[model samples]
Target: MFDDVIQEDVLLEMKYVYDYVKIETAFPKYATKKALQKYSSPTLLFAAENDVFFPSKLIVPRSEQIFSNLTKTVILQNSSHMQNNANINKILTEIEYFFSN
Candidate 1:
């Protein structure tokens, strides 16, 4: 049950939250290393293989630098900036894996 389901105010707030989620997914989570504390909130990064803007070459390194509890970095093959996500099965399984542990 949601309040103000389609009202302009609610929609604007929703858009802001959605935008934040989309942006945050690109990089890693907050970083704090007590000399590599070894455990932090697990972050799963799904990068589009054909995405020129945020290629694995850039995402991977940036992730490693910040996320101490990096769970996995999955490159979605054949996917681009606006992916229909052909690898739904793989992606879902990875999400399961992330949640299970």
Candidate 2:
């Protein structure tokens, strides 16, 4: 089980992501654009700074264009895809504030 968690198995930024799920970058030009167009709810996107699977640099830019009703987009600095070691206080603060309004 643990052996399956090898780096070679992990999907890179957006490479070959479409084979599994619809995603943008280095593949079809916004293949999920039409899918997102139907979702008009106020959304908040949080990207991890050091996440290779879905890095902030790659995702946030595309999200800005895709999510028409984005309430806010935040890049969690010094963070990664998994939040095992993430700054909990900061995360809570952001979530609290976003929903508080």
Candidate 3:
């Protein structure tokens, strides 16, 4: 099996996350004050200004209030959840900037 082929210690574990899943599933459990207080870290919460599922007007402020340590926020003025060319480029730039310093 794939798990056996690579040594557990040698293989880095990564999980693909869908934002909708967080909103629907995890949020109910983890979006409480106690949960936020438990896991405090530097966070970069990005929201699309034009996102249909999660608009920046809502998500940005909510994230800022919830996360104990929010490093930055970059909202693409005219973007959606799909991360189109303009949004992708903007996000990529923010990511590069985040890791550089």
Query: Quick one: best lDDT, which candidate?
Result: 2
Cα deviation at 91, candidate 1, in Å, is 1.4
Model 3 agreement with the true structure over 20-88: per-residue lDDT tens digits: 235344334337556779786667778877777678998887887788788998887766665555556
lDDT (Cα, tens digit) per residue for candidate 2, span 1-101: 11123254343533466567765557455636678878877788888888767789999988887778889887877677655324556678888998888
Clashing pairs in model 1?
A: none
The true-versus-predicted C-alpha distance at residue 54 of model 3, in Å, is 0.6
Error of 3 at 10 (Å): 33
Runs in model 1 with CA error above 4 Å? 1-39
- For this target, which candidate reaches the highest TM-score against the unseen true structure? 3
Error of 1 at 87 (Å): 1.9
Off by over 4 Å in 2: 1-31, 84-86
Q: Which of candidates 2 and 3 reaches a greater TM-score?
A: 3
Worst 10 residues of 2 by lDDT: 1-10
The sequence of per-residue lDDT tens digits that candidate 1 reaches over residues 1-101 is: 12112556656877898877655445554455554576567789988766766766667787788777777899876666544424667889889988998
For lDDT, candidate 2 versus 3, the one ahead is 2
lDDT (C-alpha) at residue 14 in model 2: 34
